[model samples]
Target: MLESLKFFILRFDRRRRFFRTLAPAQRILDIGCGTGKNVTEIQRLFPSLEFHGVDLLQDSQVPPFVQYKRVDLEDGALPYPDEYFDAILVVHVLEHLHRPLRLGSEIHRVLKKGGRVYVETPNWISLFIPSLAVDRSQMQTINFFDDHTHVKPWSRQGLYAYLGACCHLEVEKVGTVRNWLRLPGDPFVILAGLVIPNRGNVASAIWNLTGWRIYGVGKKSTH
Candidate 1:
């Protein structure tokens, strides 16, 4: 039951929404794909679309028609020709980059003009919310640095600026997602929503302020 609930929350996450948006792309690349889990799910929905996954670790259970490449992104350039992919999914991957600009340039190079690039990163605000954390220690640390490898924790605005500056991509959508309800704080929000008129919007705004993930969708410049 707990796992089911988690899946329900995941379905509404920004990454899943980004996945849905690119269902029609003829070719999709999943960078830092980590076993092609996301792409495998996407293939279940759109099986005809070609999928490619690149990660440092090899996946043992890869699906058919999906190409998996074990590439050390830190050491070398991605092995695709310029403008090779129709869409690129960078979900929860940017923060791990040591040279985000170099990879950003490569992403821009491999994606066709007018193609979409979906980026989802941890919201800086989530560090302040304990319910968003997995343990007491994480809450105390309060920076989502539990992994220690998350070198870049971006806000929605930061995501927009980085993509615009580095990749020269056109920003199409920027917002928060997985703005789930918390314990004490959300109960009050729910109460306010029930008692006051148009206060639901206010409550929603509050939750968005504390949302867990910052999401961005950008288009490769047609020029």
Candidate 2:
């Protein structure tokens, strides 16, 4: 019931397409999976699907449902065989790398032909957010540099191009990720930001209005 409500408010159409596009996928990979949040939530909807995750985090830090592989994306290739995953997700992880696009080849190598990849990263607008990291502990990521790990920032055009040049990848779509339905509450979120000074959830709504994150999706060529 809660998930359905969020679907309507935060991301109705995009969420539908996200799940619908992957309904036929047999196996999926989440790159830079962090604490396995992506796979954890996805598993609820795809109990029968095989899920895998690769990240620099300790195996114990990730959820058990996923096959977690500890890998440093900067030093070496992903620890996976070619043509393995039917779907791959790289969300908010590329910026941490010094050369963001260096892993494109590895992504192409691991994803199956005709498989799809979804990549999202902080766009140029994310760089312009003011009052970056006021408290140091909270209210950070709204300003891209607040996360010192974010060495490289990306734009929609760059991500779109990376998919195409990343080897046998057919770029399907590129756009700023925004919850158009959330627009109505943006003013309240902005006003709350001034009063409560919380960049966590309050800023999320404002970011949606600004289209702070950009995304691109591409499919590996069968040939």
Q: Estimate each model's TM-score.
A: 0.74, 0.91
Candidate 1: where is the Cα deviation over 4 Å?
Answer: 1-12, 59-64, 130-143, 179-209
Model 2 bad stretches (over 4 Å):
1-4, 13-16, 132-136
Q: Which whole-number lDDT from 0 to 100 does residue 194 have in model 1? A: 48
Measured on C-alpha atoms, candidate 1 has an lDDT of: 0.73
Least well predicted 10-residue stretch by lDDT in candidate 2: 131-140
Candidate 1 differs from the real structure by a C-alpha RMSD in angstroms, to one decimal, of 7.4
Candidate 2 residue lDDT tens string, 8-116: 6744534335755677899999989999776776787778989999888888899998888888888648888899999999988888887656589899999898999
lDDT of 1 by residue, 63-130 (tens): 55678888777753789999999998888888788877778888888999889988887888755654
User: Candidate 1, clashing residue pairs?
Assistant: none
Which candidate number maximizes TM-score? 2
Q: Which pairs clash (backbone N, Cα, C closer than 3 Å) in model 2? A: none
lDDT at 144, model 2 = 76
